[model samples]
Target: DRVQIINDGKFIFSDTIAGLNKQRQAFNLLCTLLAPPSVTSLQKISGVTAVETLSPSQFCLHYQPDLNPTAELLNLAVTQNWQLTELMPEQHSLEDVFMNIIQQEQESATVEQII
Candidate 1:
């Protein structure tokens, strides 16, 4: 599994289910029972720009840097008494890490130039 953050503005998550049936089952359950409300609630969250289901087992959320939604979503699930499944925030890809660094540097340079 991998995630890429571009310009600190968009989040892209990718994974495969070729060898993972449990993940698929959980995902199906989430989608069937929790997805609609969760997605709706997430859409109402401030700074959330987009919500998308990338696959049966994967969903991606695009939000502002200030809003880290993992906790909120987990809390929502818990509060709603949904079974807690393994929801992981995968490590950012090396490429994404490098890009984020470069982007920060560029933004810093831009700020300096403006000043």
Candidate 2:
């Protein structure tokens, strides 16, 4: 059983997956359901794993639970410019950033259609 934080640490998620696809699935589940980063980054890390969506605002990740992978994932967060914690009160969350981008894109589309 692996435990992970989601949505800037607003919720905790857990689950388990079958062989070969376990580790990647866990991470992807967290990103997709909870706090999403860039889709490109998820695609890179998700690679070849299965994912299960939980509630509309949460997710449960299933992975092999490797001790070594913890550090590896941390490194990945750094390299990809992603934050893994929700402890700060002054910073925008990963999800907020993406949501703002989506909003901007939608607004731009609407304005263009009106022109």
lDDT by candidate, in order shown: 0.52, 0.42
Off by over 4 Å in 2: 1-35, 46-48, 51-60, 65-68, 86-115
- For model 2, how does the per-residue alpha-carbon lDDT over 24-104 read when each residue is reduced to its tens digit? 322332432234454444334433243344444333333343422344445666776565552111233445544554566
Error of 2 at 58 (Å): 6.5
Using TM-score as the measure, the top candidate is: 1
Tens digit of lDDT per residue, candidate 1, span 1-115? 5333345464332334432322232211122223335567656655567777756445565666566566766776678764445555434545554555567768877999999
As a TM-score, model 1 comes out at 0.43
TM-score result, candidate 2 = 0.28
Off by over 4 Å in 1: 1-38, 82-84, 97-115
Q: By lDDT, who's the top model here?
A: 1
